[model samples]
Target: MAADTTPPALQDFLTWRLHRLAKLTDRQSSDAYTQVFALGVGEARCLAAIGQFAPLSVKDLAAQANLDKAQASRAAQMLVDRELVLKSASETDARGVVLTLTRSGRPLWKRVMRLIEQRNADIFGCLTKAEQRQLEAVFDRLIAHADARPQGSSPATP
Candidate 1:
């Protein structure tokens, strides 16, 4: 048979498209946060997670922020160095610690949250309300499916 001339449909791949979207979204947020708060993406995520879920452990922040333990720890330390988050021993777990926004951090968190809301609206503005809802539902399903899979398992495998 003659050599196949068709190009790979990367644009049509769900994973590829989602990855592209994520990168775009992250870059936009990163730029905005850095401009306003002098924070990198990981640091901003950790800050937001801590602000939104105060009195939570670092492990919980890592899980909520979708960051690994090391990354989360680094971010937490940075936040502490900046005095934006307060770290203290966990009341429930003697060996564990919890994080919460400092007085200064609360106002910053509010501003960041407002910016995020605007950014999300701008990003999803192209879609209709129904389409947005549909997309969110689909994303929920995709997230659940991916999260339920065994780590390192090939998608093509059982």
Candidate 2:
């Protein structure tokens, strides 16, 4: 009967490392968005989602932007208030509302897309083309595996 001497290190955790990377890139993107577009990260994401996939409902935008419904709704409202996006009645669902970029927002959306391209290049520039392709494949597989798992289910013990 003895207490365990070994302890887990934060650096050894894959999730923590991934989160750190995500935070770093997200911070950089957030700063860029705020400085260039005067937008919060959520607002920028909502705008991008609406621009890329017009006629989206709040729920659809949330999924597209990887945001919660509440966050998406709030961002959509802000975009609507700023006249960057138009909110209209959904054609399929009478009670549901659809979101689309406004005429003024088109140019902004193009700029945003360019900024995204630049940011991607800046972030992944260190990796070789082969490495980038491998990384993308690995990420796709991991995402697919995670998506296939049932919610709230714990991983099996190694």
Best by TM-score: 2
lDDT of 1 at 152: 87
Q: Cα RMSD for candidate 2?
A: 1.9
Candidate 2, lDDT over the whole model: 0.94
Clashing pairs in 2: none
lDDT tens digits by residue: candidate 1, 53-73: 888798999998889999999
- Taking every candidate in turn, the Cα RMSD to the unseen true structure, in Å, is 2.4, 1.9
lDDT of 1 at 52: 87
Clashing pairs in 1: none
* Per-residue lDDT of model 2, residues 1-158, tens digit only: 99998989988999999999999999999999999999988999999989999889999999999899999999999999999999999989989999999999889988998998899999999999999999999999999999999989997897
Candidate 1 — which residues are off by over 4 angstroms? Answer: 1-7, 156-158
Residue-level error in angstroms, candidate 2, position 8: 2.5
- For each candidate, the alpha-carbon lDDT, in order, equals 0.91, 0.94
